[model samples]
Target chain A: MEENSKLSQFQPVKSIFEINREERMAPGHRACAGCGPMIAVRQILQSLDVKPVVISATGCVEVTTSTYPDSAWLVPWAHVAFENSAAVASGVEAAMHALKVRGELKEERPVIALAGDGGTFDIGLQALSGALERGHRMLYVCYDNEAYMNTGIQRSSATPFGAWTTTSPVGKEWPGKAEIKKDIMGIVVAHGTPYAATASISHWKDLMTKVRKAVSQNGPTFLHVYAPCNRGWRFEPKDTVEVAKRAVETRFFPLYEVENGRYRITVPVAKPRPLEDFLSLQGRFSHLLKPENLEVLKELKSIVEERWSKINAAASVQVQT
Target chain B: MAQFEPVQTRKSLLTGDEAVAHAVRQSSVDLVAAYPITPQTIIVERIADFAASGAFTGQFVPVESEHSAMSACIGGALAGARAFTATASQGLALMHEMLYAASGLRLPISMAIANRALNSPLNIHNDHTDVMGSIDSGWIQLFVENAEEAYDRVIQSFRIAEAVNLPVAINLDGFTLTHSTEPVEMLSDEVVRGFVGRPPKRDSLMDEAPKSFGLMSLPDSYQFFKDDQSRATTGSSVTISQVEGEYAKLSGREHGPLKIFRPGSKVMMVMLGSYAGTARTTARRMKNDGEQVGVISLGWLRPFPEKQFLDALEGVETLMIMDRSVSYGAPAGPLASDVMSLLYRYGIKRKVIAVTYGLGGRGFLEEDAMRLFRYAGKSGSSFESFFFYGGE
Candidate 1:
């Protein structure tokens, strides 16, 4: 597990402007400047080869993009509620099939569901599981910001250990969050999805590639994209991308994909940076760096290392086969 | 042109649930997304059988839960498909949030609710508690008296919803209408097709003209959207009457939103759902016994059939209203509250005896209806109003 094993490598792209695709998400919407999830949203729309109908669960992206009387979406978009985007997309896919069978529609468009970590890992887990298990021809993208940022930094299952969220405050008895981040990708993979991947906004090329591959399949695909929130993490807006990049470098959030039950580490880390390098940049983790909380910091590092080793093992087995 | 000619019909004995499924089968629906729940389970089961046998060619999605069921219906409708779903009691309660979502989006999806009681000790019995709780969810509510009305309303509900650009719920009593078999005169597929016609074209998610749906509204425009929805719902009475008029011409069955049996009586008994049949029979027997009594059954509750309901109560000075559900901390029952409000609006002073009965699938016989009517008609007992029947 100590040896860095690379299965698939992504070429470093010089700029996002080189990819010649129409920007389906219009500019001048309500998203905050330096918002990490909006970057993922823009790239996902640009990566799509077909005209896709988008289903959005209630969150930052949905509220910001879809204010009444005006919408930032240049394509068909819908925001149903907070927890039912997957099920809504399933219905849209089924309707597309039905319409095609009846010859009412000339061609079938792809269906995509977009939600946050709160929607995906917690409230929407059942719906996501149902959509994946039913094998709907759609792609579900979870833009994880680690907590419920829209509701003002409430702790979610996706909130990491030692993170200071409103619901998981740093108190005398409790350092920060008492629980580790939920393994949502594992839960999704256990559904036997044809394609599932973990991505980060820092790696735009890798994230876009996975999006294209996901929609090309004739079954459900899942993409869990790590989005760094400057507001929630109490970091400067300019440091959003830097913070995300450090997360990947520390192996805190790995970039990987699984296709047909085979795992492939997309961006393998040769030598991971120290966990403190990532934690020092954000105020949410500043309390954990104190001398009195050094033990909690040590535990977090071990947890991160253990998760990285598991991914390395899973990818290495595929290489050996 | 089809309305000018004689229509061919077939007679079959069907429970209310089967009748709704048959309507769906013949309605040329594009999708039926539902989850199985008691009483209403047969509706989806029958739709599944129809899908299996090729009688219904629509997409039938057995969703994981009622919340997902309603969500899928909203999605399907947004994608320009005529979607339908069914649930009962707890299932409807589970779908309460999405009910507002469906109507707020103005998706025009039709649903059949096998009216059942909400559970505390978990009873699967007939009551109006589920839909009563969702009364403010903004969907057009239609109450059916029997299997035939359930079948007819299911078809009419589609046209009504589509015409008004809103969702409609056909409320049929759980077990009483859903399980009890009754003879229904089903219109032929051709006649039914002609009656409903093809769905009108609208701006949909799949159309060439791209538009966003279910957008968030802040304080600036939220009230406008709700005002528009409210106007559309209340204004649906005109469209409803027009569609029912057209349907009556074709099927020779003319049951409007409000029906009066033995109108112009001094004392009237008003209620909704299948119990109206009992009230009708009981009212007749009491009239023969030299009592001035009548029965009024309302089919549409949301739009409230205000004008016709008032006109039917021309000479009535007293009303004995029966409610199958209770409204805790309110002045009266759900239906009675609406009636009282309508009376207050019109400045019509009538003594109202608000009574609750037949809860949790309990049987309501002719004796119960006659006893309530007699109790309300008694001269000196008028002071003691607003009580429950068959209860301590």
Candidate 2:
């Protein structure tokens, strides 16, 4: 496990410039500066070779693109209610099938569903589960910011343990968010999706490659992308990618994929940068300077490392994604 | 004595539910998220048989619950497949969340609701309560009266839904219409093809590339998405009538959002589903002896068709809103409340009375319809009236 953790981070280059400068996400939009989700989408769309239909929930991505008719999206797009993006997308995909079987749509054009942590982890899970179970050739990409950023950054199931959201504020022996982040990728994999991967913005190349593989490969593909938030995490605008990279280096967010049933690490940040090296840069962990606080944070990193090792092992337990 | 016009190329004997199933097959819907309940079982059963016999290539998910049924349907639809689903009564009620989701996304899809009264004490019979329960879920709802209308309406639903890029539900009474077999002029494959036509665009949510369909929404985006949904559904509200008009050009039978059977009567009785047919029967009896009674069959329920309804009811001195559902509390039953609300909004307040009929879907027979017309004749302000017809 130690040897695997130190493996060099995988980087795929051709996908980077392969993206069209004419972004599917148009230029004029309503997003905060250095928005991680939008950047993740940009990298993702770069990998897609076809004009895809985009379904988004009522989140930051949705608000930014569709604001009173002037959509920032260059592609055909729709924004459904918060909890049913998966369901709404399901209808669109079904319609396409009907059209194709009866000779309506050509055998091309990919469909993708983009959701936030709150939508995928909490409200929209049932619909997502059904979509994966149906085995429709669609990809579900969750831009995880760890909280409900669109709804004022409230704590969600995806919120990591000890993170301080408004609700999980740092106070009186309270360690902010109490529970560990829900391993949603596991739940998605349980649905028997053909492809599942955990990626982050720190590794844009890896993210894009996995996305391409996900959509091109048959059946349902799920890409859980860790996107850092400047506002949510109280980090500098320029540190979005830096913080993401630190996350992987400190073993907070590991890059891996579950194909069929086998697990493969796209980029193993196993050499392990000290947890302090990552936390010192973020305002969210400012209070962790106390010696005892540092101990707890170290414990958290240990948990993340242990979890990744098991995940890597479990990936090999299954095959044929 | 029978005379044949030979207007339709083909005909078939079937129930309303069977017609709906056949129409689903003819349309080649990709997935069916079905939650089978009584009287509505045949629709799913026939479709299931079709799938089993290698007839339909789509996935017909037999969901454990109505919520899951809609969930599966939505998933398949998102994957860029033609989808269909059926539900009734408690099952329809169970799919409450998904109903809003399906419409809010503005997906061009269709559903068949075997309308039945909801239960507390438990009853599985024909009524509008089930469909009425979710009438405001932003769907383009079309109520059908007979087997022929049911079949024709199912096909028309797809056109209406696809044209406006909205979800549509074809509502019909449970056993009253769904189980009652009747002669229906089933369209031949060629004529049906000519009328329905293929999907104009194949812009599926699913393509081979990395395109995302449905995504989670936040507060910053929920309202705008909802606004778009409302626009599409309301647009469909108007478009459905036009689709029906065009359908009439080819099928020779038509129904609209607000189909005014006989307007300009001093008194009018409104109804939906199979009860509309009975209400029309009762209206004719009442009008024969100059009773000044007429019937209005409501089809598209969501947009409410405010101006159209007000105009139809303007000449009438008295308006009786008869619904086959209960609202539990407040004044009028579901239909009556919506009508009165519309009238009040338009500042055209006439003598409007409300009454609830067919609780648990016992029956909305001709006598019940006559009784409602008679009640409309005798002007009263019993806004929360429940009629226990022919009780011991």
Candidate 3:
């Protein structure tokens, strides 16, 4: 993990502009300056060769980008309620199938549902599970920002352990959030889908590659991308990418994919960094650094290490098979 | 508008559920996403059977929940496909959030709501509570009196909904009409195809030109979007009547926003849905016995045909408003509230008696209607008129 994190820092920044010149997602939207999800969405859209019909759940992306009458999407997009994007995408895919069968639609168009962690891991889990289990030919992209930032930084199931949020504040006998983040990628993988992967905005190339690969697949696909929020995390806007990179280095958000029940770790970290390296950068975990809260840090590190071991074990078993 | 002569049709005895399925088959629907719910289950079951038998070529998606059903319908509609779904009380309530999403996006998805009473102790019988609860959902609502009207309205709903780009809810009395078999003269597939025609391809997600749908609106622009929705819903009145006129020519039956049994009468009873049929029968018997009683049945509820309702009530001495749904703690039921508001707005002063009846599928009889009309006719101002019938 230490080696990969160092290598990422020294590696030259690839010009995404030269790779794909067309901006399917237009500029001048309502996304906050230095918003991590916005950058991830642009890169993901750029990776798609076909113009996708984007179904967005009610969250930061939907509210910021398409604010009634004026929309930032240059591609065909829709924003339904908060927790039914996947279900809506299933409908769109069914319609496309019907239209294609009737010879009304000529070209193949991919249906993509974009949601936040609050929509994906929490409220929308049932709909997402149904869509994946039904094997709809669609891609569901969840921008896991750790908390519900759009709703004033409330703690969702995606909020990391010991992270402070509005609902899980750090004060009065409580250090921060008492629970670990929900394992949403594991749940998606369990559905036996054709493609399911985890990506982060800090690693744009990896994210774009996985997006392209997922979109090319035939059945249901899910891509959970790590997105850091500046306001919610109490970080400087410029440190969004840096915070996201540290998260991967510390094994907080591992980059991996489960394709056809086979596990593969995309960005392997040889020596994992300490969890403090990632948590110290954000004020959400500032309370954990106090002298009395050392046990909380230890607990968080142990959890991360345990998760890393599980992923590695799964990869080794896949290799043997 | 060009007119086609009424073509010979086949008569079939079917329940309201089967009638809806037949109408869906004839309308050339592109997709259906639905969840099974009581009183509304047979509708989807029949549609699924039609799909299995190769009678209907559309895609049938049996979703997990009513929320997903509406969500899927909205998705299909956004992709430029004619989509539909059906549900009853709880299922409709589960779909309450998506209901707003469908209309706010203006997806023109048609839904059949088997009107059943909501649960306190859990009742799966007939009432208007389900549809009445969604009065402000921005969808055009049509109440059918029987299986034949249910069949015809479902077909006309597609044209009205698609032409106006608004979701339409066709309400049929659960169990009363949904389970009771009745003879309906069905239009041929060719005539329905010509009547409904092909839904014009709109600027949708499938189109080459990229468009955004169901966008979020901030406070600065949210009200304007609502205003646009209001205009679309209200503006659909003309298209509704025109489509009904066209449908009347094809089916040899006329339907509209409201149906007035006796135009000019001293005493009138106003209601909606299948209960109007019983009221009409009682009114005929009363008229024969020298009492001037008439029935005005409301078809459209969301647009709330104020002009037509007021015109029908003109010169009537007393108006009795019948509602199947209660507005707890309020002075009257939902229908009575709207009726009184309309009467108050028009500066018309007359004795208006509001009564709530047939809740949770309790049978509403013609005797109850006659008794209520008689009591309202003779009672002075001190009468306790606001009450629920057949309730403890």
TM-scores of the first chain across all predictions? Answer: 0.94, 0.91, 0.94
lDDT of 1 at A215: 74
TM-score of each: 0.95, 0.81, 0.94
Best by DockQ: 3
Q: Which 10 consecutive positions of candidate 1 chain A have the poorest summed lDDT?
A: A1-10
lDDT of 3: 0.86
Off by over 4 Å in 3: A1-18, B1-9, B382-384, B388-392
Q: By DockQ, rank the candidates, best first.
A: 3, 1, 2
Q: Which one is best on TM-score?
A: 1
Q: Write the per-residue lDDT of candidate 2 for residues A1-321, one digit (tens) a residue.
A: 011111113234565466545567778888889889988988887666566677777788887776654667667676656766666555555555555565545653566888999989998887788777766667888999999888787899998877888878887777777789998988997887888998888787788878877766656789999998889988888888898888888778888988886788778664888877877787777766666676657667777778877876675455444
Candidate 2 regions with alpha-carbon error over 4 angstroms: A1-22, A291-295, A315-321, B1-13, B28-39, B52-84, B89-108, B118-126, B136-139, B161-167, B200-268, B276-319, B327-330, B337-352, B365-392
TM-score between candidate 3 and the true structure:
0.94
| Model 1 segments more than 4 A misplaced | A1-18, B1-9, B380-384
User: What is the fraction of true interface contacts found in candidate 1?
Assistant: 0.70
Q: What is the DockQ for all candidates, taken in turn? A: 0.68, 0.18, 0.69
lDDT of 1 by residue, B97-163 (tens): 8999999998889999999988896989998999999999999999999998888888998899998
lDDT of 3 by residue, B248-367 (tens): 988889878899987777777888999888888988988898987888899999888988988897778778888888888888889888888887898988777787888888877888
| Cα lDDT tens digits for candidate 3, A51-150 | 8889999999988988667899988998888999999999999898877777788865877899999999999999999899888888899998889999
Model 1 clash pairs are: none
The residue-level lDDT of candidate 3 at A15 comes to 61
